[model samples]
Target: MSLEDLYREVILDHYRSPRNKGHLDSPDFRAEGVNPLCGDEITIDLAFDGDQVSQVAISGQGCSISQSSASMMSEAIKGKTKGEIEDLTKRFRDMMSLDGEADIGLDPDRPGAVLGDLESLQGVRKYPVRIKCASLGWNVLLEALDGEPLT
Candidate 1:
């Protein structure tokens, strides 16, 4: 099968059986975001081990792109320091072309090779309308990173 087809399959797999799809009873940080344009919403709950993310739980409702993005983000950020997660977030945003560029520092030909399964979402950029759907989870993650801890 083609690379594009492979990526599409990866996305579908994540959507159908998402990882970290739940809630944390006590999260160090938590944030929720909504894409009013498309009604995609995501809530990120983080449990940190000092400066690193020890655990992550995500509960939300949205399209495949948004939900799968959350699943991928949860996998990528676990056991990562806030700084590392921030860098990964920037790299992911770059891949999404949200910052006017898409330089993920790896060969786009071999997507799953790096960034876990996130690069699979790159194709969403082709449809500008779906970009937000693809990034709704990342946006919520950023808010959780920068916002105050959950009370």
Candidate 2:
């Protein structure tokens, strides 16, 4: 099996059985995101301890890319500080961008360099239209973290 095949399998696994797919009893922050183009919608609920994210839950209806991305994001951001989440968000956006090389901004020397399975979605960058589909959950996550009103 090739690397692309592995990434596809990872995405399919996450889509079929998502992680952190639910809601919290009383979340500190919540935001919803929608992609009008593809009709993907997601809601993110987050609970924070001090400046770190204590817990996260997501409920959504969307394509495999959106749902799986949300699942991957929920797992990746758990126990991370707001700064780390923001940085990850930036890095993820960079990865999704079509301009220049796709550097996920993860340094191998760092603790979380692998980006877990989230890197599997890097292939989506080739499909410019699907980028928004994959980013739906992440955009909602950023909004929730920023205390921005849901759109």
Candidate 3:
């Protein structure tokens, strides 16, 4: 009915049916991130074909916010080129900051037509503590892209 309700539904959907939630098999890169404050942890594995991310996977356990955010992260970057994925990652990070109304790395005209429900986490700006929870997997994924081991 309302936008908040829609966001809640989106979050719930991701939490209930997590995407890419498993171990990596011969992954090209992997990285892990932990939020000591909340004990939220995530490890992401990335497989790149040249500059494109051919596949992404993860294994982790945490609160619904962390796990669902990880699910959304995996889904958003699938089939995306390295540059495009990086742009989306920046956009997602900017959204979490709620710095302004600009879509940052997104096409302002189209918004998140492609990212779909995953964009609902923009509301996370309201919960400062949960910001790290939502970013856990994304940060780890970035490390994987950088060819760093999961720390």
Candidate 4:
């Protein structure tokens, strides 16, 4: 199997059986994000342990890219401190960004150098319009972290 095939399989696996695909009963933080252009929506609930994320749950409905990306985001953010999440978010956004400015040494040839399985979704960059679909969950994550209201 080729690398692309592996990425596809990873994405499919996450979409079919999303991680943390639910909601916390009393989360410390909660927020939602919507990509109106593609009708993708996501809600994230987070519980913090001191300065770190102790738990996360996500609820949403959308395309495979959106849901799977949410699953990956939940997994990545767990046990991450506020600063770590911020840096990871930047790297993830830079990875999905069209502009060539990944200051964190994220080379396209080595997309997984920072994000682990989340890198599998880098293919979404090929479809410019679908970028929002994949980023819906991440945006929601930011909102929750910032204590922003659901939208």
Judged by lDDT, which candidate is best?
A: 1
TM-score of each: 0.91, 0.85, 0.82, 0.86
Q: Give me the displacement of residue 106 in model 2, in angstroms.
A: 6.8
> Could you give candidate 3's per-residue lDDT for residues 1-151 as a string of tens digits?
4557335877988888889888767788888888887777888888877777778887888987788889988988888887887887777777777444435454447745746666677667777777788778878877778775333
lDDT: the better of candidates 3 and 4? 4
State each candidate's clash count: 0, 0, 0, 0
Candidate order (lDDT): 1, 2, 4, 3
Model 1 residue runs over 4 Å out of place are 1-7
Please estimate how well model 1 matches the true structure, expressed as its whole-model Cα lDDT. Answer: 0.85
User: Which scores better on lDDT, 2 or 3?
Assistant: 2
Per-residue accuracy of model 1 over 18-121 as CA lDDT, tens digit each: 99988899998999998888788788899988888998999989888899989988999989998899898888889889999887677757757878788888
The 0-to-1 C-alpha lDDT of every candidate, in the order given, reads 0.85, 0.83, 0.76, 0.83
For model 1, state the Cα shift of residue 117 in Å: 0.7
lDDT of 2 by residue, 1-151 (tens): 3546335888999999999989988899999888887778899999888888888999989888899999999999999998999888878888887435477565645634567788878778777778888888888998898895222
Pairs clashing in candidate 3? Answer: none
Instruction: Estimate the TM-score for candidate 3.
Output: 0.82
Which regions of candidate 2 fall more than 4 Å away from where they truly are? Answer: 1-7, 98-101, 105-113, 148-151
**Which one wins on TM-score?**
1
Q: By TM-score, how accurate is candidate 1?
A: 0.91
- Candidate numbers, best TM-score first, in rank order: 1, 4, 2, 3
